[model samples]
Structures are given as C-alpha cells and as structure tokens.
Target: MVFEYAPAPESRSAVDIAPSYGLFVDGEFTEAAGGRTFTTVSPSTEEVLSEVALGGAEDVDRAVRAAGRAFEKWSALPGRERAKYLFRIARILQERSRELAVLETLDNGKPIRETRDVDLPQVAAHFFYYAGWADKLEHAGFGPDPRPLGVAGQVIPWNFPLLMLAWKVAPALAAGNTVVLKPAETTPLSALFFADVCRRAGLPRGVVNIVTGAGETGAELVAHPGVAKVAFTGSTGVGRSIARSVAGTDKKLTLELGGKGANIVFDDAPVDQAVEGIVNGIFFNQGHVCCAGSRLLVQESVHDEVLDALRRRMELLRVGDPLDKNTDIGAVNSAEQLERIRSLADAGEAEGAQRWAPACELPERGYWFAPTLFTGVTQAHRIAREEVFGPVLSVLTFRTPDEAVAKANNTPYGLSAGVWTEKGSRILWMADRLRAGVVWANTFNKFDPTSPFGGYKESGFGREGGRHGLEAYLDV
Candidate 1:
C-alpha cells in the first residue's frame, strides 16, 4: 500500500520551528557568542529547516562553568525536591508531546507514527520512572550513602533525538547533578524544545545547558575539566576516540555505541510471527537503530523458504514522507548518512553478495534509500561484518545452535540479538551464548524505562534505561 498522509494515529500536530536556533545556556536561549551559525536541513526535502548556532570551545567553557555553578546548589537540594522537578518536566513533555513528535519527524525523517507512538511515549516514561528514583537512592543498592556526580556532560545521537535527551537528563537530574547536553547537529529542534520544557518546569537557572553544533563542540564538552561525568551515544569509531579523549581524566564516562545485531530464526519458530519480527528487526527507524538486527541467521533447512517470505514482505513496506501516517520507513537522517549507506551497498555488490531492493521510487529531493537486502552474504563479506546504519540487511544460514552462536558472536559489536524459537530451553541456551547486552527472545526493539538497555563489547559501555541508569550519575 502507498503511504498516505492521513491524520496522525495519535492525532499529533506539526510544530513550527524558529528561523534561527540559539544556544540554551543558563536557562535562556541566546545567540552564539561569536555569532557563528550553521544551517540544519530537512532530510525529507533537502531544504534548510533552520539556522542553528555553531558553538565553539569558548561557548563550551561558558556552559561548563554554568553547569558547575548550578551543580553546587542543585546537588545540595534534597532528592525529594529534585523529584518534584522531574515530575514537572514529565508533565510538560506530555502536554506538548504532539508538537515534539512532529518536530522529531520533521527533523529526524522517521515515521510520524513511530515518533508519536514510540519515541514520545518513551520520552515521557523515562522521566516518570527516573522521577521516583530521586529520593530512593539509599535503597537502590549503590551503597549506604550515594552522592551525586557534580556536573554531567551528555552527547546524544541523531537517531532518537528527544528520547535520548530524556534518557540522559532525567537520570542525571534525579541524581541531583546539573547537565550540559549536546544534541546532534542534524536534529536539534526537539532538544531545543526540551530546553524550553526545562525552563517551564521551573528548573533552576543553569541546571541544564543545551549547546548545538558539530563534532568540534562535542569534543569541547567531553574534554571540559569542570564536568564530573560524561555520557555519550553514537558510532563505535567515535566512541573509541571519546574513550581515548577522556583517558587519564578524573571524569566518570559511559559510552553507548554501534552494533551489528543478529536475528536468529530456528526451524521450529513461528513462520509468520518470525517474519514480522524480521521486518521490524532491521527496517524500523530506517535501520538507524544501534540495536537493529542487521544480520539474519536462519536455520539452513528453512533458509530458502524464509528468504522468499522475507522478500515478499519487504515489497509491502511503504517508504516515503516521514510525516505520513502509513510510512514504514523514511529517509536517512542526513545527506552524509545516505552517501555512507550507498557506498556500503556498492561495496556489498562488488564483494559478491546478491543485493535486492523493492521496486520503489525514491523521492527526488530528499536523501532516501529503499529497504534493501543482501543474500549469499558470507562471514567474510564486509557488509556482513560492518554496521551498515541503513535499511539494508544481510542474510546467512546456520546448521545448528552452535553455528548460530558462532556467527552471531563473530562481530566486534555485541549490542543486541533476537532468537525466534518455540522451545523454552533453546531460547535460554541461545540467550546465554549470545554476548550481546540485550537478548530479545520473541520481541525486538522494545524499550521500557523499567527495563535496562545497553550493549556489550564495542557496542559501548553503560546502561541507559531503568533504575540502573542512576548509576551513571551517582558517585558510589
């Protein structure tokens, strides 16, 4: 079915963005100190969305100092008081959830359905869950007495802009720490709106500072000596560099990075349910998800049958305008990301993998790529080994549970994996052997504030959601 732009299922409306973006510093939005600004374009139309301030090291220093100053008083406030602040923020997020969802879709190029139903709900839920934790730290198993880390520097990715901000900030504030956050340069609108939420929540001035720019600004924030802790979620390559950048510093760091997750289907698995899971495993969010199941390991006996079914299912996925209520997949986040995906697809064909894409017309202006698949991919193939952060998936076969385990654990990333089987014993056995941080037995890509989420190995360190999330902000 063609994706139609009907009313949002949740009845969310689009938000109007300011012509120019400003720095949210010390509780107010201000122009860049040097008046240097850059444009943010919509990936759906390839048109400039707004001009955002380009913050430099000097701006970073100012934000850090403001955060440090706020930390002195914020940390001294009782946990119950901090909990009230979080609850207020949560209420504001719900009140303006529709506006935030639309801005998220406009800026990030994800389906309005997902932004409304998935991301926005989780964004509010994260704050709600963390709010209850603010005063319960002593009972949280950290120690007899847990203290807040002074100031936290948080860097979030372009995939889930507002959701990631909520994940990083809610826990830090609940732990009684002030924050300096940097949203991805491509998708800064929702985060900017979030900064407004903080202001409306009556959070103390300088408690949260949002600086928008590219990698240079991020490096400045991560390297700032005044920050007591750092939390980052991005590419594995960049995560390694961040690890090195913070080395020898006294800052506490939590890194959440890339993944090449495996989705294993056993011969005894439910065929229709497994196929639906397979579609959602890799295609959801245009395959930009760090926990996306990019590698498909099927039981050899049913390999050909499953591949045919998967291909037929892929044909039905609607790819187009993210604002459409029916779109299953949308444009990549940016032009640069589209180019990277195209380059990797080219290399996959050159490396002898059979590539397949549904017969679909890509939009003329925006950076869009069809939902693609590569078959006969070997363990040695680059596409099978690397994290292709696009709507492209690789297919491989396994003869036994042991072989499935081996192939699943082959990559440097251990973020997440899916096991589809009817047998209870096999599910547990497979879950144990897979080295990923998250193992989805019958479900894939489910997020809850009550559940712990993170990755193992090069997928990065630190958990994001759940009670354990407080650990990142607390000095035990």
Candidate 2:
C-alpha cells in the first residue's frame, strides 16, 4: 500500500501580496497612528510575508465611529436590497476562491486543499444562506418587526480566518447591522482582502470595517460606546475577560470559546467507520478546532483494534508544505502555538499516559508535530482533561454507556460531543444525557450553514450559524 506520489504544490501566483498593508476603515486603507507596523510570517517556512499596520485604541475608535455612521443607512435599507448586496458578496467569494485559498495557505499555514474545499465554500455559503434570511426575518420566529443592533464589534481567531469572519459578519449584515471586525494578528491578510471584496460588492462605505492589531485593538472595539453588540471567538480566558468587561453594559454579547470535546465509541460501533470519524475529529485543521474531539472514549472491548487502525492511518498522512496538494497536516500556525501543543503533550507523557505517534518525517524548517495519540489515559490525566488544541488524541476506555457519559461530562466545557454507535436508541439516549450543545451521531466535526452552533458552561454563550445567529445582531 506504500505508493510514491509526485509533488503537487499549488501556485502562489493566484493571489498577490503587497509589501505592506494598511487598516481598512470607512472604505479606505489608512495608516496607523504613528505608523506602527508588525510583520506577518508564513508559518510553513517562517518566512516574513508582509508588514500590517498595527491598529491602536484610536484606530478602534475610528472604525467603531464609522460603523455607527453606516448603521443608519444600512439598517434603513429594505431587507431585499440588503440581500442583494450580500448576494453580490457571495458571488465574488465564489469567483475569487482559488486566489483566496492560496493566500490563506501562505498566511495561515493550512493546506490549500482545506482552504479551498472547506473554508472558502463555507464562507460563501454562510453569506448565501444569510442573504436568504434578509427579506424574510419576520418568519424567523424573532417577531414581526425585529430591529438591528446598530453596530457589532466582532473579533475572530486565526484557526479559520475567512470562515469565522463570514460567520459573524454575514448574519450581522443580513440582520441590518454594521460591523467592525478584528482578525487574529497572525492571519490578518485574508480579512484585509475581504475588506477589498466588500468594496467591490458596492457595500456602503462604512458598512464593514476591519482594524488590524493585537489584543488592545479588540478590547477597545468591544468596549467602545458606539458598538451595541459584541461577538467573539477565541480562547476561554479571553472570552471570560470580555464577559467581565461588558458585564453591566447595554451591549449584547456572544462568545464562542474553547472546548475539550469527547468522541464516544461503543463496543458495537463500526470500527473502520468510527476510525475515520475519530481521525477527522481530532486531526482536521491539525486539531486547532475548539470543539475538536480531543478526548476519545472507546469501549474497552474494541480499543486495541481501533488504536491500531488509527495509527496506521496517521502514518499515511502527509505533513509538509501547506501549498502541496496532498498535505493532510500542515505547519503549526506559529511558534507560540507549536510550543503550547508541545508543552501540553509533554505534560500528558509526564502524567503517565502512554504516548504513541505515527513514524513520519516532519519538515526541517517550520512548526510541525506528528499525529499523536495517548492510551492509558484517565480522567485525571492532563491530556484527557485539557484542551490540547493540536493534532493529539487522548484515548480513555469505558465499559458502559453510563461510564462513557460520566467521563465525557467530567470536563468544564460543554461545547460538542460525538457518539459512534449503530443503535438508534443509544444515539438518542446519549444525545439527551450528553451536556454538549452539539451532539453528532456516526460522524464528527460535521458543520452546516443552517445549524445553530454554540456551547454552555465556560465554552461561552449564544449561537453563531443558522437563523439563531441573527439574534446576536438583532434587537428584538
């Protein structure tokens, strides 16, 4: 089964990158106050890609004010007219998908295949799906004459830059709210490119604004008096801070935070099929997913066979240049993220879980970690409890469905969970008992534009996709 394959690297020429980029505010690219800038590097090779203007508190203020100005007209426009603009944006996204895919791979160190197939399509679909909801808001169960929230301050993480932007912005705009978004510092280029997409769509001047910077800019944007609603997707700690900061304010808040999701497998589960779901659950996007199935709760009876199949599959995964067409796992997003993965993994080993990884050659330069698994893991083990947020799976065995539920629900996160049993009763029974917002049967990591997704407990509150997402940007 060992077959040699030729290289199939995607061309980088599809998208052009300037030496430097400025903040996108009020339909213009403006320099940062005092000309502050930061270099964004390609994680695959640690190459300096471009210097982006660093926005400060003043820039956040500027962007929020612009969004406030645009809100009056954007909200007043008929929903059908607004839908036309959203439709235009979706069409443009489809047309430029290839270029945006290549740029995303270069900037975020994700495989071009994933960027092309998964992220870009979903980004476009969110817009198209939300556009359909624009003129039909009354039937959405939000009452007959729901109103827009005026201005939304959104902050997205780097894992899936363009898609997360689409998740927040599309629904907000469809609900007639203007937005000021801050993309993660490491992967800011694609969001900047999106600003251009907005301009080409003839979206009103201040309808969508992007400020580039680190934490300070996001803090300012969320706390700005002009911003009436706040949406954020990032680490749990940061989400907590945001909740505290906006505690007594009139601003509406929605946070999509961290998770340590569990994937449960019963003795009767289909072994090969479950193996694939398990792999996709933890290894997709190098397990940068917040709701990734990082914890595996397998029945003790079939544990050995499942682990063997999973290890063999992991061995075949190609880990190298993100531009390469066949790469399954690309580079870690940054040195910081790579170190965090390593530290948590080492803790797993030190805590006495048996660590196993497929034998593979990682690239000489760049942040890389082999697909890894840990057996002999328990609820007390760090790997089993903590959100590794990398391509690492912690395997813990359970004897019964009750034990599986207990172990899965032990964590503080209640974001997502998966069940891999063939029995219809078992899937429904477990779904009810599982404390997660999303429960998948037979498959894991399946997402749709129409499904409302959010979490309980520390995983943060509110829904992001589907009709429910409109609530975040609407004033009922």
Clashing pairs in 2: none
Alpha carbon lDDT of residue 21, candidate 2? Answer: 98
Off by over 4 Å in 1: 1-13
Model 2 lDDT tens row, 365-424: 988988899999888988887788899999999998999999999999999999999899
Provide the global lDDT of candidate 1 against the true structure. 0.91
Q: Cα-based RMSD of the predictions, in order?
A: 1.8, 0.8
> Residue-wise lDDT of candidate 1 within 1-476, one digit each (tens)?
87554644433335778899799999989888889999888898888889999998889899999998898899999889999999999999999888988888888999988998999999999899999999999988899799998889999999999999999999999999999999999998898999889989999999999999999999999999998899999999889999999999999999999999999999999888899999999999999999999999999999988888998999888888888788899889998999999999999999999999999988898989999999989999989998899999999999999999999999999999999999999999999899999999987998899888898899988888887898988999
Quote the positional error of residue 103 for candidate 1 in Å: 0.3
**Local distance difference test, per candidate?**
0.91, 0.94
TM-score of each: 0.97, 0.99
